[model samples]
Target: MRMVPMAEADLDAVLAVQAACYPPAMQEAADVVRARLRASPDTVLVARDADGICAYLFAYPSRLGKVTPLGSRFTLPDRPDTLYLHDLAVAPRSAGQGVARRLTDAILARAGGLRHSALVSVQDSRRFWESLGYAAAAGDGVALATYPAGALYMARRLSA
Candidate 1:
């Protein structure tokens, strides 16, 4: 599978993979996902093969320490210091295939000028993010409260 910028035609498959990867409570409604795509098309990436989309990463440029709430739209800032990774999901078919790492490398390659990166590590996935060099950081508790209790706000410094 290869990672590429997501297109409108890929939304359905992306949403399907999202549903299969995340629990119902963490799932974003179709409308909300649409809004996110519309708001920051350049930041969304999709990986696919003959079977169709199997992995995706939704992210956008934003201020450091800030996060987009679950199922909410994002507005790219005029000057962004961080690349906020909103979601990264891989379908069962793509599991254990290094799909997530490839997509993440694609995002990082495109974010070379950013000062930092941030994400919400949910469902006890902090160890996974930690492996990528992200560490827990103080964030908006109220904003993060919308996610499950295990969610952690994590950040990593980027070479400028």
Candidate 2:
């Protein structure tokens, strides 16, 4: 029903939504999730209704070409020029309700002067992201090897 900055108390609900939204292989451990929030509390957000948390977005500031390996802790960069959209998940019950779009819009609005927004698309989500202005980057497997075979590194230039 509403979006709010993620809080430590919201982790349990956030993890539950994440588990329901992603496959086992794609889920991050609770510690890693906590680390990411600690690293970028400003960018992480949660959408909750009277029932509980239904969606969440975990993003952070980072360099243009840097990649956060799947299932790893958030690695804060010294000077980040890009807003890395590390994870976005909506519970099955919340699907088709535009929760992702709202969260993404809020995050981008918060990006301020960041030059770009980037993310890795997994589970054949390229089309969904592409519709939001993201484009797949042509890169060697070596750079994206940490992801599942079909994953892609995608980016979108922001309008300053």
TM-score to native of every candidate shown? 0.96, 0.95
Give the total clashing residue pairs for model 1: 0
Encode model 2's per-residue lDDT on 1-160: one tens digit a residue. Answer: 9989999999999999988977888888999999999999999999987788999999999878778888887787888888999999999999999999999999999997999999999888899899999998754456478787889999999999
Off by over 4 Å in 2: 138-143
lDDT of 1 by residue, 57-93 (tens): 9998898878778877887888999999999999999
Question: What lDDT does the true structure give each of the candidates?
Answer: 0.88, 0.89
Question: Which stretches of model 1 miss by more than 4 angstroms?
Answer: none
Q: Total clashing residue pairs per candidate?
A: 0, 0
Number of the top candidate by lDDT?
Answer: 2
RMSD of each: 1.1, 1.4
TM-score attained by model 1: 0.96
